[model samples]
Target: MTSTDSRTKEDVSSRTKKVPPPMYKVILHNDDYTTMEFVVEILVNVFGKSLEKATQMMLNIHNKGKEICGIYPRQIAETKVETVHNLASNKGFPLKSTMEKE
Candidate 1:
């Protein structure tokens, strides 16, 4: 390619900016019907949290009645919350989860 064309292409590439991924917070709401054991299991299995971390989070939810489970990119956070909700519902529990912008 010509030097002029190459320089023009490089300039355009340098000027173009990539849009950053949106941030989201995944939250878990406490419920009487869902046992703490189930919450811990979900945290461990779905969120890849360690057993101790999952227990701590479960306790937080129990005492605080709600807690932010984790932060992630928008789509991923939403998906995680949705997966947890569905799993809880399928297991006949009233557990609820949601995601919002960080």
Candidate 2:
């Protein structure tokens, strides 16, 4: 094979590197109007936390004012935050969620 053809093959392999998606943190913000039980429910339903773990998360929010609920890729984290906000608004609670780069 010609030198140019060999160079082309080598270049193709060098370009094949895969980049991993950046991660993000989904966070919950506490509010007095939102009940502790509701926060636990959100953790269980939205983040797929177990009941026991959900309860612990709820307690954290209660005492900490805010806490990281889950870590996900950027798109997933954004979708999760939007879902939480919509669910909270529909239930008439001032529950807040946000995502930050991890």
Candidate 3:
């Protein structure tokens, strides 16, 4: 192929390659006042965990003081943290959630 054609093909190939977005892990922190039942509920409802898995995670949080709930894109991680906080606050619990690069 001509040099111009080769360069155009390279350019098109590069343009077609997509890079995945950076991911973040959403973590739930344990606290004295946040009930285990509530934590399990959040895991099941917000993170879409099954009852058995939610209970396991809840136990992990209770015993270890924290657990990573899920991995998501930055906006989704931020939204999950905010949503957990809002729900906890509305119910007068002190459960906290945070996001970290994955």
Candidate 4:
């Protein structure tokens, strides 16, 4: 190929390598006052988890004392955590959620 074509290809490849996928983690913390039902509901509503999946996640947090709710890009994970936390607080539940780099 021409030198110009090869240079263009190299530039494209370098650009792709520089743009990495952002990472985030959504975490649910265990708490005494947050009901299992509420936790499951938050999982379902906020995280778009199915009923079965929500149940399993709630159980994991209960049994293991904490669980990673989901992994998403930074904005998504932050939004999920904020939404869950708002719902819980509004409902008078002490359920806590957080996000961190994965």
Candidate 5:
């Protein structure tokens, strides 16, 4: 085999290196009209947090005015934010969520 063929094989192997996808954080913002219980429910239903953990997060969101609910890849995080907005809107709450690269 020619040296060029060996170099081509090496290049292909090098290009096969796996890289992890960029992660994003999904955050919930507190609002005066949104109830604490609903925030906890969203945590439990959307982020799959346990009841206890969701309660704790709800407290943080209440006290701090915002909190990160979960870390996920870009598309998943985006979908999660959209879900939160839709759910809140359906329930007549002004709750909001956003995503940021992490």
Candidate 6:
């Protein structure tokens, strides 16, 4: 093939190659009224953290006001944030969650 044709093929292949999706951090926000036990439960049930790890994360949220629960693709992070809000609200707690690009 001509040099020009080869260069075009290379460009096309590069364009077609899959690149990894951008990631986001799911963060939990602590509130005065949200019990520490509930925070731990959310971490364990929602994020799949072990009880020990969940307890550690809960403490971090308690002390720091917010902490990242996990990193995931943008959509998953957003879904997780929404789920946390829904569950917390349903239970009459003011727990909050948010996502940030990573």
Candidates' lDDT values, in order? 0.91, 0.92, 0.96, 0.88, 0.95, 0.94
* lDDT of prediction 1: 0.91
Backbone N/Cα/C clashes per model: 0, 0, 0, 0, 0, 0
Candidate 6 lands at a TM-score of 0.88
Per-residue error at 12 for model 4, in Å?
4.3
- What lDDT tens digits, residue by residue, belong to model 5 across residues 39-87? 9999999999999999999999999989999999999999999999999
Model 1 compared with the native: what TM-score? 0.82
Task: Say which candidate scores most in lDDT.
Answer: 3
Model 1, position 17: C-alpha lDDT score: 63
How many collisions between residues are there in candidate 5?
A: 0
Better of 1 and 2 by TM-score: 2
> Which is the winner by TM-score between candidate 1 and candidate 6?
6
Best-to-worst TM-score order: 3, 5, 6, 2, 4, 1
Predicted candidate 4 versus true structure: per-residue lDDT over 13-86, tens digit per residue: 88778665688889999999999999998888888899999999899999998889889999888888889888
For all predicted structures, in order, the TM-scores are 0.82, 0.86, 0.90, 0.84, 0.89, 0.88
Residue-pair clashes, model 6? 0
- lDDT of model 1, residue 30: 92
Q: Mind giving the per-residue lDDT tens digits that candidate 2 earns over 8-77?
A: 7668777896788999999999898998888998999999999999999889888988999999999899
Model 2 bad stretches (over 4 Å): 1-14
Error of 3 at 45 (Å): 0.6
- Give the least accurate 10-residue stretch of model 3, judged by summed lDDT: 1-10
Per residue, candidate 3 scores C-alpha lDDT tens digits across 1-102 of 477656777789998999999999999999999899999999999999999999999999999989999999999999999999999999999999999999
Q: Which candidate model has the greater TM-score, 3 or 6? A: 3
